[model samples]
Target: MKDNAKISSAVIKRLPRYRRYLSDLQKKNVDRISSNELSNLIGYTASQIRQDLNNFGGFGQQGYGYNIQSLYNEISSILGLDKDYKMVIVGTGNLGQAIANYTHYYKSGFMVSAMFDVNPKLIGLRINDIEVLDYERLEEFMQDNSVDIGIVCTNKDSAQEVVDKLCAGGVRGIWNFAPTDLQLPEGVALENVHLSDSLHSLAYYINRNSQMKDQD
Candidate 1:
């Protein structure tokens, strides 16, 4: 595989979509696929798909195209989905609990090892058998467990503090769902899901489409 840092973020972002399509193809027992066939399924031009995949190396043959299972496995490995990751969630509110349940039911390689919350009623509860401990115990828990990811679902005011504690405890990555932006030290990976921003983007597209129709 080529150096990931040398690859553009746009290409990297598209990898998950490629993997998803490949996984669906695998479910249908499609053994081989030409770039053109994959393009039709994924809505990317064949040339674009070929170029994006070439960053990781030549995955498809000239005429034989790609072996579906092999390509699927390779993409899974590339996305680091082949490995198991243990995570802890800070905040046991609706969103946090929903994420916990979703990962537990659907994501086989990711485990929610613990949950923390400031609410006493929420504390001591178990979601999918993972106990919700006190927020105050978070630093201590982090000191003991080898957590790979920290999920922040708290309010924006508390998100940074929770993330700081998680980072101090040695989490290598953070999945942030708080509404505000956060800063992390060098080396720790951060992924943010800003719900309001996404909704705003959707509204912008909706308004643009309405205006275009009006013009017509």
Candidate 2:
């Protein structure tokens, strides 16, 4: 197995794509898949596929390609899908509700245990079977429950306050979906998810491609 030090983040990021496609293959009852076959589905070259997995260790056989189930398990284990993670969303706004409703991550090790919101209407309501607890009780609720990750889906005005409370409550990992850039203490893992930023990135590439075509 490849240690964290020896692996590249790009390789780690692609591991999810591998696991996702492998999972699809499992559902189709496909037992084994050659590198070229897998490459066609995932849009990666066969050699690139082999190189990526080689970073982690032996996965493919000489003549046979790879056992679909075995490769899925290996990639899943590498991505820490073998463990359980509890998450709490600190807002019940549109984005938070959408995430709670749409994401099936709960079925795959990362379960969203609770949701919090300041709006009186949203508090005590259930979205996607998970009850929205009042923000007033956040500290008490956190003290009683085990939250491994905190999702900040609040507005810019209230996002930092919610994050600070999560930090004070000893929560380690945070997924911020707010517009504000959050500052967290050292040792706390933070992932700032700016949907607008991603859209802008897409716009940039699209605009660039259009300009190139015009010049051509």
Candidate 3:
């Protein structure tokens, strides 16, 4: 650990992109890649890649560049993917069920062992081959199963309560998909997924490009 306490959030945020791109390269049989090559593939400048990787000790060689598999493993280890993580979803709605069905997360070392819902119909149902449990048992389930991450797919109204219960049950990470902001404790890692915000940015860029074209 290279004193991650000092690493900027922006740098930390790019690790997943690096891992995903490296996996893509591996699938294409790319063995080694220089920073400039990687930059072209991922749209990040070579200097940006160097700086981001340098935060955790760069893996690039002086002239040999980087070995794709080795670099992927390095980034995976940094992202805590070397160890299997048990996950539980707090809601079994469409969003929650979609997340449960997302198999790529499993390939990335996260296992969705269980799901929860308050609706009587959703409870006891199986999604993605995992049995849905009653939300009432969430706290006990967490205590017994050693959940590493809690995926909060609840509505915005219930998001905080879900997070509180999950954290209280010893979950160290929360991937919140609700449409609101949340506050986490000192050591807990929080990844807030605001879907509409990205769409809003897309619309803004489209409008801006249209205006630029009008001027041209």
Which stretches of model 1 miss by more than 4 angstroms? none
RMSD of each: 0.8, 2.0, 1.6
lDDT of candidate 3 over 87-175, digit per residue (tens): 89998889888888884355767889889999999998988678899999998898888898999999889999999999998999999
**lDDT string, candidate 1, 1-216, tens digits:** 789889998897899999889889889988999999999999999999999999999999988999989988888888899999999999899999999999999977999999999999999898999889999999899998999999999999999999999999999999999999999999999999999999999999999999999999
Number of clashes found in candidate 1: 0
TM-score, predicted candidate 3 vs. hidden true structure: 0.94
Q: Candidate 2 at residue 10, lDDT?
A: 85
Clashing pairs in 1: none
Could you tell me every candidate's TM-score relative to the true structure? 0.98, 0.90, 0.94
Q: Write the per-residue lDDT of candidate 2 for residues 1-216, one digit (tens) a residue.
A: 668767987888899999999989999999999999999999999999999999989899988999999999888888788999888998888889988876644476778888999899999899778899989989998888888899999989998999988988878899999999998988788888999999999999999999999999
Range of the 10 consecutive residues with the lowest summed lDDT in candidate 1: 70-79
Distance from true location, Cα of 168 in model 2, Å: 2.7
User: After superposition, which runs of candidate 2 have C-alpha atoms over 4 Å from their true positions?
Assistant: 104-106
Candidate 1: TM-score?
A: 0.98
Backbone clash pairs for candidate 3 read: none
> What do the candidate models score in CA lDDT, each in turn?
0.94, 0.89, 0.90
